[model samples]
Target chain A: MSAFAALVRRDLVLAARIGGGGYLSLLFFMVVVALVPFALGPDLNLLSRIGPAILWLAAVMATLIGLDRLFQADEEDGSLDVMLGASLPLELAILAKVLAHWLTTGLPLALCVPLFGLLVALPAEAMAPTALTLLIGTPGLTAIGAVGAALTATMRRGGLILAVIVAPLMVPSLIFGVSAANAAMGGTVPFTTPLAILGAISLVALVTAALAGAAALRGGE
Target chain B: MTATGLAASFWNLANPTRFLALSGRVLPWLAGLAALVTAAGLYMAFFTAPPDYQQGDTVRIMFVHVPSAWLALFLYAMMSLSALGTLVWRHPLADVSQKAAAPIGAAFTLLCLITGALWGKPMWGTYWVWDARLTSVFVLFLIYCGILALWRSIDDPGRAARAVAILTLVGFVNIPIVKFSVDWWNTLHQPASVFRLDGPAIHPTILVPLLVMAVGLSLVAIALHLSGMRTEILNRRVRTLTILQADHPSEGGI
Candidate 1:
C-alpha cells in the first residue's frame, strides 16, 4: 500500500480502537445541543428557527475538542518524527491524518446533525441542508484545527489552548455554514451561494492548512 | 544602494546591542514628541474643533475612538510584517518585535472596543450590537488573545517564534476578510465618514484634530512598541543565562 493510504488507515484504526476522544466529541456535540433547548426553553418554534445555528456551533466545539489528539498521540509515540523522516512527505502525511480525523470526527458529527437536529427541533426540510452544510464545512474546521494541533503537538496538555488558538480561524466556516443552512430554511438569500463559498473555503483549507500544519509540526520538533 | 545592499543595511537593525543603543538614544526624543503631539491634538479636539451639529459633545469621542481603531488595525498589520520577517527571513529581532507587539496591539484593540461601546451607548442607544463591523472587530480582538495564549503556551522562544509567526500569518488573513465584511453584510456601523473617495465627510474642524490625534497616538504606540521589543530582548537574555546556570551548578551565579 502507498504510505499515505497506510498512514490514513493507521489513524482510522487507532481512533476506532481507542474510541475515547472521538466518541466523546460526538457525545459532546449531542450534549451541547441538548443543553441549548433547556436554556432557550422548550419552544419548538424558536428552536426550529435557530436550530441550524445551534447544530453548527455544537459541531465546531466538538471538532475543537477532538483536535488536540490529532497530533498529540503521534508526538507521544514518536511516530510524528518517523513520518517526518519518511519519504511520503510531511504535508501529504499531515493531509492523510486530517482525512482520517475528519472521517472519525467531522464526518460523524455531520452525519449525526440530523439525529442531534431533532433534539434542537430542526424542521425536517432543514435537516438535510443543515447536515449538508456541516458535511461540507466541517472538513475546513478539521483542517484549520490540524494546524493548531500540529503547532501545539509538543505541549503536554494542549487541548484547551488549541481551542483558543483555533476558534477564531473557524469563524468564516461557521458563518457560511450557518448562513447556507439558514438560507435553505427560506431566507431571502439563495442557499447555493454560501454553500459554494463553504466548499471553496474547505478546498482552500485542505491545501494551505496541510502545508501550514506540516511546517508547524516540523518547527515544533 | 542596490536592493541587496539596502536589505543588508535593514537587516543590521536586528542586532540587539545596536538596537539597544539606537533605541536608547532615540527613545527620549520619541516619547517627548509623542507627548507633545498628543497633548496638542487633545487641546485642538476639545477647545477648537466645533461640536457636531448632530452629535454635539459626544462627537468628540471620535478623537479617542477613531484613532485607537486605526492603531489596533495598524499594529496588527505591523505585527504581520514582523511575522513574515521571522518566518521568511529568519530575523531573530522580528520575533521579539512580533511578541512585543501582540500585547500592545491587544491593548489598542481593547481600547477601541471600550471607547466604541461608550460612544455607541449615547449615539446608537446600545452599547453593543452584532453588526458586521462590530463582530469583525470583536473577532480581531479574539484573534489577538489567541495569539497571546499561543505565545504563553510555548516555553522555548525559538519554537514559540516559528509557531506564532505561522499563526500570525494565518490570522493576517482575517484583516482583508474583516474589511470586506462590512461591504458584504448590511452593517449598522456608519459608512466611511473619513475615508471617502471624494473627501472626508467631516469639516476641517473635526478632521484636523482627528488627524492630529491619530498621528500622535500612533507615535506613542511606536514608542511603546520599541521599549517593549527592548524589554523582550533583555528578558530572553536573562532566560538563557538562567537556563545555563541550571545546567551548570558549579558555575558562580552571575
Candidate 2:
C-alpha cells in the first residue's frame, strides 16, 4: 500500500514539476469548449443545447491524449520493472495509477467543465449533473486507457493505434455521459440513471484493464 | 453434399494446403452460387414478392438491407468466435479466419448502411438520422474498422493478434445494441416484427427469398473466408521462412 502511495506521490510530484496531465487536459477541454461557441455564431440556445456534449466529448479526447503517457514511460524506463520486482501487487499498483490518472486528468476536467458550462450558457441546474457525469465517467476512461496503454506500450505508432482500439470501447461511457447531461438539460429524467450507468462502466473498465493488463504482461514476458 | 457434410469438409480443409486446393476448385462454384442466388432473390423480390401497400418498392429494399445487416452481425460473431479460438485454443487457422473476415464484414456493413440510407432517403426524406438502430450499426462498423486498424498497425504478429482479439471481444457489445436498439428507443426505424413476439410479419414470397439470399451469402462468406485464411497462412509461412533465412545466412546469401 505504501509502495502504491509512493508511486502515486512520485508521479504527482513529477507532474507538478512539469505541469501534470490535469492541466494539459483541462487546457484542451477549455480550449475546445471555448471555441465551440465562437464557431456556432454565439447563439446561446444552440450552445446551451450542445454544450454538455462538447464538454464531455472534449474531455474524453483530452483525457485520452494523456493516456499514452500513462504506463509507457515507466515501462520503458524500467520503473515498471522495479515495481514488479517489489512486494506490491501490480493490480494495486495499477489501481493507484488509475486513481492518479483520474486525479490528474479527470479531476481537473471535472472542475473546469462547470466554468465552460457558463461559457456555453448552460443553465445553472445543468452544471452539477454535467460535472457529476464527468467525475463518474473519467475514471472509466483512465481505467480503459490503462489497458490500451499497456497493450500498446511496445508497439510503434501506439497513440493512433490506442485511440482506434480504445475509442470504440469508450462508447458506453460516451452514451451514458451524453445521456446524463441531456437528461439534466431536458429537466425530465433524473440525472442519477446515467450517473449510475457511468459508474457501471467505470467498474467494468477497471476489471477489464486488470485482466487485460495481466495478459499484456504475460505477453510481454 | 449435405450441409453437414459440406460443413465437415470445410473444417477438414482447415489445413491451408487443403483449403487452398479446395477453394481453388470451389471458388467458381461459390461465385456462381452467389450470382444465382442474388439474381433469383432479386427476381423473386421484384416480380414475385407482393408489394406492400404501406412501403411499396421501398419495402423491396428490405430484401437487400436486412440480409446485409444480418450478414454484418453474423460475420462479426463468427470473427469474434474465431478470435477466441485463436487466443484460447490456438487454432492454426483461427486468427487468419478472424483477420480475413473483418474487411468482408466491413464491406457487408457498408452495403447494409448504404442500402439503408438509400431506402431511408425516399421514405424518411433524409440521407441519415441518429436513430438507435442506425447508430448501433454504425458503431458496429466502427468496431470492425477498429479491429482492422489494430490488426494492421502492430508489427509484431503475436502482439497484433492479442490486441485485435481483445478489441474484438470488447466490441461485441455492439451486437446486443444492434439487436435491441429499436426496442430500447423510439426511433424513425420501425419496431421489430420479423424477429419478435408474433414472429415474421412478412409474406412467404419475401421470406423465402430472403432466407435463400441469407444462406447464400453466408456460404459465399465462408468460402471467401477459407480462401483468405489459406492466403494468410501461406503469407505467414513465407514471412517466417524469410526471417529464418535472414537470421542464419544460407550458403547462397541471396
Most accurate candidate by TM-score: 1
| Clashing residue pairs found in predicted model 2 | none
Q: How large is the C-alpha RMSD of every model relative to the true structure?
A: 1.5, 3.5
In candidate 2, what are the lDDT values of residues A1-221, reduced to their tens digit? Answer: 48889989888877777785758777888888877877889888888888888888888788778787777788788888897887887887778888887888888888877688889888898898898898889889888888888777776457887887788778889988999989987767788888898899899888878777756655554
Q: Largest lDDT belongs to which candidate?
A: 1
lDDT of 2 at B3: 100
Report the CA-based lDDT of candidate 1 relative to the real structure: 0.90
CA lDDT, candidate 2, residue B116: 96
The alpha-carbon deviation from the true structure for residue B214 of candidate 1, after best TM-score superposition, in angstroms, is 0.6
Interface RMSD (Å), each candidate?
Answer: 0.8, 1.7
Per-residue lDDT for A1-221 in model 1, tens only? 99999998988888888885568779899899999988999999999999999999998988888788788888998888888888998999989998998998889898987788889888889989999999999999999999899888999999999999899989989999999999999979999999999999999888878788988988885
Model 2, position B70, has a per-residue lDDT of 88
Give residue A85's error in model 2 in angstroms. 3.8
The Cα local distance difference test for each model comes to 0.90, 0.82
CAPRI verdict on model 2? medium
| Candidate 1 wrong stretches, greater than 4 Å | B2-8, B249-251
